[model samples]
Target: MSKRRFIAALIGVLVAPLLTVVMPAGTASAHGWITSPASRQEQCRAGTVSCGEIKYEPQSVEGPKGLRNCHGNVGRFAELNNDGKGWRVQNVSRTTTFRWNLTARHRTSTWEYYIGGARVASFNDGGAIPGSTVTHNVNLGRTGRQKLLAIWNIADTANAFYVCVDLNIS
Candidate 1:
């Protein structure tokens, strides 16, 4: 190749990846966390559990919908998937109120709560934007120490946000 053409091609190859890194697809416009019951990320953020990079971005455990684990299937926050991480199990009542603190609200499809892989409760939003703080009074029918999974499904995106809370239900 000619000198000028070769240099231009080299620059193009070098800058393309940089541009991709600089501007990733589907930038996160909205994020939230289960703040009341203290999800695994919250435990990391509160220093109750020694965790990894998830402590820095607790509200970013985002992944595809229908995932059953904590960390939202994201590798950086994989520490959340460790059930033996000594997460503080908060004592709660049979009917507990779960709260979410949103950084930026999105059109929500629904909010689901699960225990032992079974959905205990869900509130359908029908694709409506929610407030900064959302609450759901869910009847966690079962008792004893349980790992509860909460999911925030976005209406317009193929991804969903996930958080897991260790609860000692009475």
Candidate 2:
């Protein structure tokens, strides 16, 4: 099967069984929460999650019980046109096993993953970089909120790539 089809099939397989767990059917779907724009550069004036901005400028929201609201603000270096290659965020999820699905184009540049404002994983070091849809799992236990900033920096200068995340609260 083609890569695209394979990704679709994989997503179907992964989400199909998840649908069986009834959540008392209600207006609010109990699935993972996703912000709009689906990209950092896109203008998303809605949602409790705001990206592409420095300093903890977040939109408030009612998160699930035990699931703290994650507000990620890229550091000044992470801002567009910044020369430095470092990115940072303030308090996100103080303590939790946060899993996020990052849909990005498969490339050679290093793709880092963070949760609650700390570095958790990277996709260049044998990490899977799905050109279509891919999920990165990070388990942050007993860690402070300052440990959840995931950065995907390119070793070489290149056009900014779109990175969208879907957070699943357990």
Candidate 3:
């Protein structure tokens, strides 16, 4: 083989693997979802709630923050926002712990929980990288059936993951 061709081939072999390793590390793969109290996506993942694409990727219901949709207004995950979709409400107390399972940790701005259009609780992460698991104790304050929308806002991105948890408060 020609010396130039051999040199080019050697360069390609060396650069390709390095690119693969560097690319994946730099690519943003932030993922997280509410697990305890069983968010809509969690229920779908657990086979307790029948859903669409979100059933396979509970940690991926991401969109811009300030939107109150469970599927983050994404068409593929719209099933999560369906109020009549027969999602099972877990029995909860006035105060319950909401747990987040982070598959790919990201720097977080804040974690917010809402019920009936009012934010009930929030935790500020202050742009710090979060742990594999995060928890927030929320006080629902209201009795009877309710739906809670939890949002995880990413510090570096203009996006947030949304999880809707149905609760039957005692």
Query: lDDT for each of the candidates?
Result: 0.91, 0.35, 0.89
Instruction: Give the winner by lDDT.
Output: 1
As for candidate 1, its clashing pairs are none
Off by over 4 Å in 1: 1-30
Candidate 1 at 35: error in angstroms? 0.7
Per-residue lDDT tens digits for candidate 1, residues 94-153, read 999998988888899999999998999999999999999999999999999999999999
Question: At residue 60, what lDDT does model 2 achieve?
Answer: 18
| Higher-TM-score candidate of 1 and 2 | 1
Residue 87 miss distance in model 2 (angstroms): 18
- Which is better, 1 or 2, measured by lDDT? 1
* Model 2: CA > 4 A from native: 1-45, 49-106, 114-118, 125-129, 155-170
lDDT of 2 by residue, 1-170 (tens): 89999999999999987887755543321112122213222212232234344212222111222221232222331342221222232233423332323333333355454454455565663433444333454544444323233344333333222232333322
* Candidate 1 local lDDT, residue 50: 93
| TM-score for each predicted model, relative to the true structure | 0.83, 0.32, 0.84
Residue 71 in candidate 3 has what lDDT? 86
